[model samples]
Target chain A: MTTMTSNALCFGDEFPASGAPCFVQVDGDGLTITVESEGDDGAGEAVPFSALTVSAGGLDHDHLVVKWTRVQGERTLYLKSPDVIRAFRETVPNHLSLPFAQAAEQVQQVRHRRRLVWSLVSGAILAMVLGLWFGSDLFVELAVSWIPVEWEQKLGESAYRDFLSHQEVMKEGPAVTALGEMTHRLTEQIPNNPYRFEVTVVKSDVVNAFALPGGYVVVFTGLMKKAESGEEVAGVLSHELNHVLQRHGLERIVKSLGLLTVAAIVLGNQQGLVGMMNQLGVELLTLKFGREQETEADLTGLQLLQRAKIDPSGMIRFFERLSEKDQGRMEWLSTHPMSTARAERLKAELAALPKKSPEPFTFEWKQVQTSLGSQPVAAP
Target chain B: MKSEILYPGAFPMVRVDLAAGEHIKAESGAMVACSPTIDIESKMEGGFLGALSRKFLTGEKFFFQTLRASRGPGEVLLAPTVPGEIVILELDGVNEYMVQKDGFLAGADGILIESKMQSLSRGLLGGEGFFILKISGKGMLALNSFGAIHKIELKPDQEYIVDNSHLVAWSSTTSYSIEKATSGWVASFTSGEGFVCRFRGPGLVYIQSRNPGSFGAWIRQFIPVSE
Candidate 1:
């Protein structure tokens, strides 16, 4: 076989400052290194394959370094050429190639381990995010249950006053009396209710009504104009009142303000709780209930109407009529996402209830609508 | 300038005797005492940006106190903030040294200190952070350790594993990578040695006997916390 010769730098104890340039070639069972000289070949050192240990060196870790012991001290041969490394690996005995094999395996293992660590870390973060998402919902529910009705009344009272501050409220008109009559019917139906219901009829044409926590309900004059009967108006009242009964408004506040505020309430920080309530009082008007809360309020409101012996069909008819109209400028439809599915679900619940003849209210629906003085409206 | 370490092991100080017009740079606030002939000036080494990078990236001080014997030969004593041993490394203008933060106590005028960014793995897991101080050029450099400094000289292709937190400084020729202390990950953490630096050497590595992080944690339990 042709001698595979390559240029190499040999470092020894004698030449510590700089290594000597030499030619390395594979010999029988070992390697022979010949020091380069002019016109003369110096006697070279013969190193057995068994005596050498191979490792990677250099700043970029591309150079192949072979180290062995000599009588003077330890010697190192640095080889940078890929050709030389290939030749060395091809010619060296299996035992000598073992170190190179092990080094390559080590690199593979490190890469694999890093990949494993990255995936594990990412998985942990994902799990934490999911846990916090679901856990916080449960936490909000638990916190809402602990809140006293008295505190809710105070919270609702402040928000109620803030809401009515800008609106023209019809305190003693036929519209206000009609709303009071509806409120009384709904409140009387709720058993063991902690709230003393306070309903107001605000003068606006937005066909909207909302309930604050602890029985503070507001009905717009446009809604009375839109209704054909007192039971239809009472349907809206029943829905809003159930929002207070189920404490949906309070749930929205607690969820929006976040867990820190809930923790403060749990820890009995009354002053901080009061401060948060005052700040959130105006925000309560625009707070939108979640889809689940809306559905719960809808179904429970039907049950409340049924228990009070008022017609449950009126609530479904009002919802269906609102849903059919162009939703723009309809604040109630916008806040309460009017869907055909909701009307169908209400109809299904009404069918499930035992049949009863509903009691009619004593107010004239047309007179209540005309009392607002904006226009003489047609019966829906 | 000539220098010697007095009180070698514990509470060590480097006493430097500088000839006229000779100067040495030390970590700011390192000077304990100095003669009247020695003029001290705080210098932003390597100009503004260099000093800023070293200060912010490597956690080194922005200013280096330059003590010059302007009038005549004067003696100045310098000590590190932490009570520990001091080592003097003689650079040959060829090899560079990677020093940990707070390791530099004092150095001759010929030595150049600059911040170097380590690789991501070395930065995140090696415990040396992202930036380390690179000392180069020919000069005598004084390094202070949090505890006694132990030097390990390795032969070609030889290897040694060192706890990351105990590392003080190492020759740039020495290659190292951070790895788990034990074969098993759980065992590595349970052993209280999470990551260690495995160094492949044809050079020297210096490590401290004590870990400052563990010492601080141990001392924290005794201190009373105010509400």
Candidate 2:
């Protein structure tokens, strides 16, 4: 072993954490600290000067935190005054100094490099967050396109089943059969229609009509009762059909829950609609289409009605009647724009389109109304 | 510069006394009181881009407030938004320390504040945030935490583990890894003990008794929702 040369001796032994009396013996020019353990055994260990890094505890420092190799617990020594700090500083040679101000110079150089590294990292993180946010919409849309039409139809069936459990349904009635025939006749006109549509007339007084994620067109008896003619009922159904065809509900689900959750549900047990709708029904039931989406549905539904030789004016007339009647429970219209704005906007939109000869559509409207078990409520 | 923790417990405040020409940098919105002789100047730290980076990555304010005793020794008071204790950590330049992103309140001059982004894998595996605030150089650094700060002195060949959200700061000498507190992911999640920080010593670590995340979540429930 190479003999270490230094000045200090028993530096750690003199200062006991419990303030116990200890003695030190100097052996050579090299300072080897022999720490006498405070235990009853009075054991001692030799510590070399190089194994220690001393901190002078500064001018106003309360205590000194001296790092000595192999020592456990607190090694802090209380500084009585500035003289004690200077005295402690004098113990270590200039080359072995650990003063605050002197060490600050070397740390500054390293800190400069660290600042540069952090700035770049921050910039990269910001860019990553923005990219993920913007790219997500396009990415999710593309993924949604790959989902099979069969899954959507199952989802709709599940939602319809959940709705029936939650409320009353008018299944297998003349009213439901008539509404089903009208929906099928209208749906036949759309070439390559992807959905197997089913219209259910729910036996409730709520003046609302909505389209589930799939092709389930849910029309309340109140909606049929409130309608003045068969064409008005057809107009509402056509609007709901557009919502299903455009996959707006699925788009919203992807946006809210993200691709991961959708993928999880898809990859999970495919036990029909209850598996999906049981978890997602609340959010989807109150799903509000944005202004842009509402406009798309309005314009697209108008074109579908026109192609089926049905007068698109029935769409505007039904909206105007709802506006004047001030019926607030229409979930279909509740999430859209203000009633007056929608009414005026739809009327203006119809005026811009080219005039097409619309057939005066006729059906057993009074018979369907009688089957609904209510007269049309007059606008007061 | 001389620093003292007034109250020294929950709701503790830092009172820093700056000598002539001495300066102190503090987190923005932390200053509650200051002597009239002290000049408070706010500027972008390390220049504009540096400040912007800190703002984005560390959630620090765009401007770092510097209090200087230009003429004579003056005092400034600093406090954090939450009710907590503050610790005055004195460094002699032998080591550097890492602090939780929101733990640092103020520091004596010559103390450089920088942020470090942890590896993505570590961040995903642990509860500690992606970025950690590093206080380096020679000076006093004040750290704030909910409730009182408990300092743990770790010995060599010993490993200490702390909940990630409860950990506030640790000495630079300690090597640490972000890890799961429990053996399995299912057990970790179900037990409500997720990720924790495992520190190997010999060094010091400061932790708070209460977690700010849980406290914030508790407070959030009582707040009224606005349309």
Candidate 3:
């Protein structure tokens, strides 16, 4: 009935004392167990193979544990020889012997799953750290992209407040009116602006004009005095307006403070934005936009002048006069430095300029200059 | 042999109708239900030593069941343990296919399953490299993947990139090389795509849409860990 049938030593409850263990034999019907007690009673019993099941124990030892489940309680036969289990397994093929692999598989699955989870968590954190390490510019851009328009306006207003606190804001006056009319002429052509147009003449001798966030364009008196014609003044104002239109102030803040810091400051605490104002330094006013930003502003400024029907040649003339006057040391030159390639690009663009019958100045330039002299100002 | 895919993609099962005297060799315990006419016999194939090596080395079952249609044409339903899609590839003894180790489901009698070793570097430092199971000879071989299987045909001089973990099976004619997903050190480490297998082919490569490794991580989040 089976292949490897032989006599072997086994343990059973029937034998009180052991002599030579037991002689277990396999037959067609069942296992024949021969046992001897101390009182000289030698008896044997037969168990059908179906009435028993194997305990598939750990693999460290050489033994086969047969657990009998058909009985009332449970009885076991531990055959000392390990090869008997293989012999027993091959006889009753289907669902007879436990391979121990099934239990091992379950243990492997759990251990592997935990290791897999930890590896993935560690990998994700490593990737995030490396992402921040290799490309912080990418993070800054991503953070900047997440900034809502409302937050941008709020940041702009804060920067404007910081700069304005250090200077005079010429509120309502004939000077403000003249400045407003000129800017309005240039701004009207811009479709859908996000800013409220307000021009302030700060009584400073910097000979420079700067645009604040949220459409606050501040021009210095020194620049107004230096202008040869109303077009020259319009040229400088138009350039400054381009800076405001492009939200350069906010971009600078985002670039300087780093995206993570800005994100924490702008998105987290309410006072975060204002608290970061100190790092902005005086660079907000003397802040020189990148060469790309300068070129973009110059080109955009030219378009604004065209829309207002003002001669764009005035922008070129202002640059030529300043570059000729000094190589360095001028405040405006320090911030908005002119390069030869920039001047060449402007000249080339001017050569292809369309013929426009530009309208004349509707406001008196001298009266606006005199109003600034008069100082008839009020709180805005 | 005639076969049909039942409820593919989500819960896939292959229903094969075998004519009289026809037989199918399937992974042990893969049978869900079968017709009464079909007789099942289990054996430790390739003898005792081979069976022991197959069990211990590859972590696959040593015993396989051969379900034969005895009296008349009968049906046998077979599926893998995991939820995935199953596909059958027919061979005429002229070609062979190398599949992922655990991808084997059920196949016709003539096909042989064997272990294939990768190159030393790939074998030692690869996702599924140590032992890749190969199915060859002349028969229909069924394969299972973690997700919907997608077939990509590559012409000469054309190469397709795939994540190594998602690879199911590919034509033996295709040449492949393993490389980091990107050349940059930081990007290679940080991009999360990791290593990729680039296959240059004049044949087909079957890929799974989802990677089982990533799916396991996603599933791990919802599982409760006991202290």
Candidate 4:
């Protein structure tokens, strides 16, 4: 290394000789720098100086000094920023020439990517752990108890199964034809679906529809009789379909499973998880997906109705009709959970959608209405 | 020529380009009463997991469907179990028809299922060719190459072997089974051609395209692995 004084080396100095290589060191008023020649950019001359590397001390220094080792081959120049050099040296690593600088840059990028991947993995693990922790029936009950008791009961049970059980009394002869027809119609709606979505009508006078997991939907025949047109039925069916798509039942199942898993882990036994889940059938009956999940289903259901070209406002109208019909049935309210507020909200949503008139069609409306037969009382 | 045309929703009639007294007989009514039959057949573009998953989840035979027009538009309706919109189309001869769904084009006498199938498959699979087909009765009859047809019956317990790719349609009531050659461990593992679909019971199965794997192999003209 040859010591080159700051004064001896000008900013725009010429090469000492062609094809000669040299190293330079600078010690200027408490600053030190060393540099060596690398290679060429293949343009038949020494490449111009790109960056400077400096190891510095103290906040205040004499001059921002840099020393360079000169490789003599054609013209070359050096640049210096006194103020930046001093401050940056204190705060950051000293700058390096191109080749070493490129390697460092690449290493930094690799390190950053590794850190990101690790963080994502850790976050996923944490989420799984927490899901297993908080997902419990006891915990869910404590959380859900704040909801109205009646609202929780109706939404909590498998609506499709409940509808089927209620239909058991109406199972004689030709009623099965209507059921078969309804099933056939539903089957047409969901072609290519391996998981058949069974549609069953319960002979109850309650204006209600419910969806079950693994593709099941139930509509009360009372509700069907009240439906002014097929569009209204379509609207109600779309809502139940939304519940299925949103997997409200599946969510409850997973939550119950998660709770049991956590309980087993806490209790620390291999069979503990299995035992809790097996016992969960009764416990899960009380659990409901959160309010957010319900609202999401409402929005999704509305979209499905819109896509199906059925009038979404029919849902609001149906809700209002149900509310009016059951004005005295507060005990039923505990199960059905009808409120003026919900009706108003649903109405508002309907109002927000674009209005389209139902297409004109020759109707067998009278025949359909007459087929409803006598209006049965709501199931006790 | 005898033809059966089904209108899914409303009964719309055209003058038939023939004399006023000359009329063609076709099924017309609300979709509630008269819907077209749907025959869907799908196979994996690739194998193994597809065949297994399909065996468990999908119906064994082709999806044999009978659809009647509903109270909605005369457009073809999907998802009768829940609710789906009618797919209406506008075509050269069928330009006067109202289109409700975004895809589908109307054809003479009835809406065309193939063009709609192509468009829907393209949209859903991001340009992959349709492995699933929705064919009407007239389409099934007209699209075949042979002028004369003879029905071949399979005995109740007998099995008929056919390539999965070439199967056009089959009865929904029939049971589907898979037959594979015992080429021994390594040979079976290396050669993908040993597996075939077996059909049981009496049902008509239509075969159109050649074995998809063989066709793909023949088209490349050279083995990529060998190259």
Q: What proportion of the real contacts between chains A and B does each prediction keep?
A: 0.10, 0.00, 0.00, 0.00
**Given candidate 3, what's the lDDT at residue B31?**
92
DockQ values for all predictions? 0.10, 0.03, 0.01, 0.00
Error (Å) of candidate 1 at residue B115 is 1.6
Q: Which ten contiguous residues of candidate 4 chain A have the minimum total lDDT?
A: A55-64
Better of 1 and 2 by lDDT: 1
What tens-digit string does per-residue lDDT give for candidate 3 at A1-380? 22223244333343221112345666665676654222134446577877776542211122344556434544455454445544554565455534434533554564566568667866999999999888665666566666776666655566677777889777777656767778888989888886776677888766888786667778887777666657878888998888878766667767776656656755776565456755443546556687777888888898789888998888888887877776233688777887878888887876777768778787777777676674322212
- Candidate 1's displacement at residue A211, Å, is 5.7
* Cα misplacement distance, residue B97 of candidate 4 (Å): 93
lDDT of 4 at B39: 20
Sliding window of 10 residues with minimal summed lDDT for model 3 chain A: A11-20
Mark the regions of model 3 whose C-alpha exceeds 4 Å error after superposition: A1-146, A281-283, A327-329, A371-380, B1-227
| Residue-by-residue lDDT tens digits, candidate 2, B1-227 | 88888887777888888888899888888899999889889978778887887888878788889898997888989899889888887754434567877788888777887876765544556455677777767678888888778988765335788887888887654556777768998888787768887876545788999988888899999999999
Q: Which ten residues in a row have the lowest lDDT in candidate 2 chain A?
A: A1-10
Q: lDDT ranking from best to worst?
A: 1, 3, 2, 4
Q: What is the Å distance of residue A180 in model 2 from its true position?
A: 23
Q: Which portions of model 4 show Cα errors greater than 4 Å? A: A1-194, A205-207, A225-229, A257-289, A325-336, A339-341, A351-366, A375-380, B1-227
Better of 1 and 3 by DockQ: 1
The sequence of per-residue lDDT tens digits that candidate 2 reaches over residues A64-171 is 434454545333222223443455455655545645345434445445655676678778999889877787767767877877877666656666777778878776
- The complex in candidate 3 yields a DockQ of 0.01
Q: Assess the local accuracy of residue A197 in candidate 4 as a C-alpha lDDT between 0 and 100.
A: 62
- Top candidate by lDDT: 1
lDDT of 2 at B117: 70
Q: Model 4 misses residue B114 by how many Å?
A: 82
Cα miss at B211, model 1 (Å)? 1.2
TM-score of model 4 relative to the true fold? Answer: 0.32
